[model samples]
Target: MKTKFKIIIGLLFFSLTTFAQKDQVKILKKIYAKEIITDADLVDYKKNATKYGDVAIEEEDKVYSEFYKSILPILEINALGANVTTMQKANFINMETISDLSSGLNGTLDFEKKTGKKLYTDKINETIRNFKPIFWEYVVVLDGQKKYKEVSQAAYLIYQLDKKDLERLYIAAEYALRAKEYDKSIQYYNELNALKYTGESTTYIAKSKVNDEYNAFSSLAERDIAVKIGTHTDPKIEKTPSRTGSIYKNIVESYIAKNDIPGAKKAIVDARLTNPDDTSLILTEANLYLKTEDFDTYKKLITEVLAKNPNDADLFFNLGVISSKSKDGQAEAEKNYLKAIQIDPKYRNAYINLAVLKLEGETKLLDQMNKLGTSPADSKKYDVLKAKREGLYKSALPYLEKAEELFTGDADIKSTLLNVYNALDMTEKAKALKAKK
Candidate 1:
C-alpha cells in the first residue's frame, strides 16, 4: 500500500513538473502582460534589455508579428526598465491596432503593364480600409471610418515580452535583401553585429554550425565600402606613365574594368591623337575592333590608314591577312605584299608573309626554282636572284634562304648554310654537307 501511494505521488509530482516548465519568452510575455506583475521578473527583463537591445526580426504573414516580435518587445522591455508614459502607451496602442487591421486585410492583387503580361504581373499587395480606436485593445480605422491596431498596442505588447529573442533579425535581413532593400538589411545586420552576433555579417551565416570567421560586411556594408574606396582616389595607380602608350593602355584598362567598352575605345583613339607616331596604338585600335568581333570597324581603321599611306607595310600585311582569312583576294594579296617588300628592302615580315602565301601554291615554287637554273653554277646565281624576291613569293622561299642557297659552295656561305639548315631542322643534311666540305 505504501509503495503504491509513493508511486502515485511521484507520478503526480512528475506531471506537475512537466506542465510547470514553459518557454522563458512566453512566460515573460504572460507575466508582464498582467497588471501588478512581479518586480523580480521585471528587474530580470531590465538586465536582459540592457545586455541585448532589439532582437532579430523576420518576415511575418501576420501584421502584428513584427510589432509583437520587434517593436512591442523592445519598447515594453525598455519601458519596464525606466518610465512608461501615456503618450508612449498611446503610440503602442496605435501600432497594434494598425497591425490587427492590416492583418485582417484580405485581397487578391494583380498588376498590368501597358504592354500586357510581364514578369511582375502577379505580384501581391496589401490593402485595408476602416479603423476603430480603443484603450488597451489597439485598433485603427481607415478612410470611411474603421478602427485598427495603433502604436500603443505595439509599445505595451513589447513592454510585456522578453527583449532578448534574436532569430527574427536574420529573417528580416534576408527579406530586405530579397526586396532589394539592402540598406535596411545592413541596419539589421549591424544591430546583430553590435550584439556581437558573428554570423550576422555573412549571407551564409544562417547555416553556421560551429566555429567560423565572423563576416562583418553585410550587403549594404559591402556596397558602402566599395563606394568609400571608389570615391577616394588612389593617386599611385592612377598616375599615368610618361609613355603615351602606357598611359593609353592604363586608361583603356580602367575603362574596360568599369565595363565601358566604348570608353576604352575612346581612350585608344585619344591616345592615337596624342601620339600620332605611335603605330602600335593604331594597331591596338584595329585589334580592339577585331577583338570585339567588329570586323567592319577593323577594316575601316586599317583601310583609313591605307588610304593615307598605301605603302604601309603593317597595313598591307594586315589587309593581305584579312583578305586571305576572308578568302577574297589572293592575287591582290600577293601584289600588296610585293609592294611592301619593294617599299622596305629589308622587311623580314614581308618575306615570312609571302612564304605563308605559298603554302597553297606549292607548284608555283618550281617556276621560282627555274629562275635559278639546272646546273650548280646556275643554282648559285638562281638562289641569289630568288633571295631578292621577297614579295614575289606568291609561292617561293624568301631572300635570306635564297641568299644562303647561293652561298652554298663558298666556305662562309657553307658555314652560314649549315647554320641555316640546322635552324630549319635539316641537321643530318647540314652534318653531311659539313663532312663533305
Candidate 2:
C-alpha cells in the first residue's frame, strides 16, 4: 500500500511540472513569433508588468532571451566588417524588427507599468523622446547606404508607431522625397498639416517690448519726453507658435516637383483662403507663375504686393527682370533697377543690370547708325548719330565702373568696362584693363 501511494504522488508531481514547462514554452514562442509589435500588445504588457511582478520578470527574461538568440546570427554577420551583402542587409532589418519589439516590451515593462509614479512618467517621457532620434538615425543610415528596402520597412514601422508625431511624418516625407516617392511624401505632409490644425493647447496674451524707449508727455512741462527707463510694452502685438505656413509650403513644393501644376495651385489657393495676407504664400504663387512663364500674372501679383510693402528691394529687382522681358522695356527696367539701388545701395545685381541696359541701348543706336547711307547728307547724320552713341556709352561708364568695383573678378563686367573706356577715348584706362585681363 505504501509503495502504491508514493508512485501516485510521483506521477502527479511529474504531470504538474510538465504542464508548467509547456506553458513557459508557449509564452516564449508567442514572443519570438512577433514580427511587428502592436499597440494592443503594448497595452497588455503594461497590464501584465504591473499586475504580475516577479512572474512578469521571468516571462520578460524568457522573451528577451529568445529575441537575443534569434538575432545572434545577424549580430555576428554584421561584425564581419564592411562587406555586407543584400541578404545580410535584409537580415539586419530583421534584427531591427526584433529590436523594435524588444523596445516596446521593455518600455511597457519598465516604465508604463508604473503609471502614476513621477519617476515612471519622467522615464517614459525620456524614452519616448529618445525613440524618434534613434529610429531616424537608423533610417538615415539605411538611406545613405542605399538600402532602400530597409528604409521602406523602417519608415513603415515608424509611421505605425506614431501616426500623430509630426516630426516622424516630416522625416518620412523627407525620405520619400529622397526615394522619389512624391505622392507618399505629399500624403504624409498633408497628414501632418491636418494634425497641426486640429490639435489645441493654450494661448497666452502678454505684453512684450518692441523697443527700449517710450514716448510720454509730462503735464507740468506740456512737452513730449522720450523715456528710456524701461521697456516699451505693446498690448496690441500678438504672436502664436505656428508651423502651418511652412507645412503648406512643403506641400506646394512637393506637388510642383511631381509636375502636378493643378495640385500645387489648389494647395496655394487653399492656403491663401486661410492666410489671405500672407506674403510668403503670395510669393509662392508668384513663383509658380514665374515657373509656368505666366509673367503677366506674376507681374500683377507682385505689383499688388509692392503696393502693400514697397520697400522690398528684392521685389524691385524682380520687377526689373520682368520689365526687361517686354518690348520697349529698357526705360522701365532702368527705373525699377534704380529704385532697387535706392533702397539697397550695395545691391550688386541692380548696378550690373542698369549698366547692361545702358549697354543694350548703345548697341541699338549703333545698329541704326550702321544702317545709315554713305552719302554726304547721311555722313552728317552719321556724325550726329556717332555723338549720340558716344553719349550713351558715357552714361553707361559710371554704372559699369561701379559694378566693376563691386565685383572685381567678373570677366563680363570688366570686358564691358573696357569697351566703355575705349569708346570714351580713355585710352590709358582701356590699356590698363586689357593688361589686367
What is the per-residue lDDT of model 2 for residues 245-271, given as tens digits with 9 covering 90 to 100?
A: 666777788789999999999999998
- Candidate 1, residues 1-437, lDDT tens digits: the string is 99999999999976654443223344544543554545665666454433222332222212222223332333343354446554565554545443432332221111124334342223212011111222323322221132212222332232222124344343344444444444454455445445544332224111112333233234545545544564322111112223345434544554554566887788787777767866556667777777677767887888777766677876776766666665567776777677777777655556556655654443455476676658988887666655544233323434435534444455654554454465456668777877763
Candidate 2 global TM-score: 0.60
lDDT of each: 0.48, 0.66
Best by lDDT: 2
Which portions of model 1 show Cα errors greater than 4 Å?
1-246, 253-263, 269-281, 309-311, 361-394, 398-400, 403-437
TM-score of each: 0.28, 0.60
Q: What TM-score, to 2 decimals, does candidate 1 have?
A: 0.28
